[model samples]
Target: MNKDQVKGRIEEAKGKMKEVAGKVSGDKKLEREGKIQNISGKVQAGIGDLKEDIKDAI
Candidate 1:
């Protein structure tokens, strides 16, 4: 996978960890931040996937 995909996946993992930690610690703000980060990572990964698809199609 491309750099974006790799990075995004890493971010997604990190966000998930943060979300879990936040829940366990009872931090709503951290939980929300983690959710946002997770979403952002998914978007980045999707963009990377689209780029790869286009490249392969060519």
Candidate 2:
């Protein structure tokens, strides 16, 4: 995959870890931050996918 895809996947994994850690520590803010990061990662990955698709189409 491209840089964006790789980065996004990494962020997603990190976010998941943070989310779990937050839950264990009972930190609402951390949990919310993790959730937001995870969603942002997903969006980045989607953008990467779209780029790949367009490249292939052309």
Colliding residue pairs in candidate 1: none
Q: Look at candidate 1 and tell me the lDDT of residue 8.
A: 85
Candidate 1 lDDT, 1-58, residue by residue in tens: 8988998898898888889889999999999889988888898899889889998999
Whole-model alpha-carbon lDDT for candidate 2: 0.89
For every candidate in turn, the CA RMSD to the true structure comes to: 0.6, 0.7
Whole-model lDDT per candidate: 0.89, 0.89
- lDDT tens per residue, model 2, 1-52: 7888998988898888888889999999999889988989998988999889
Minimal lDDT window, size 10, model 2:
9-18
lDDT of 1: 0.89
Candidate with top lDDT is 2
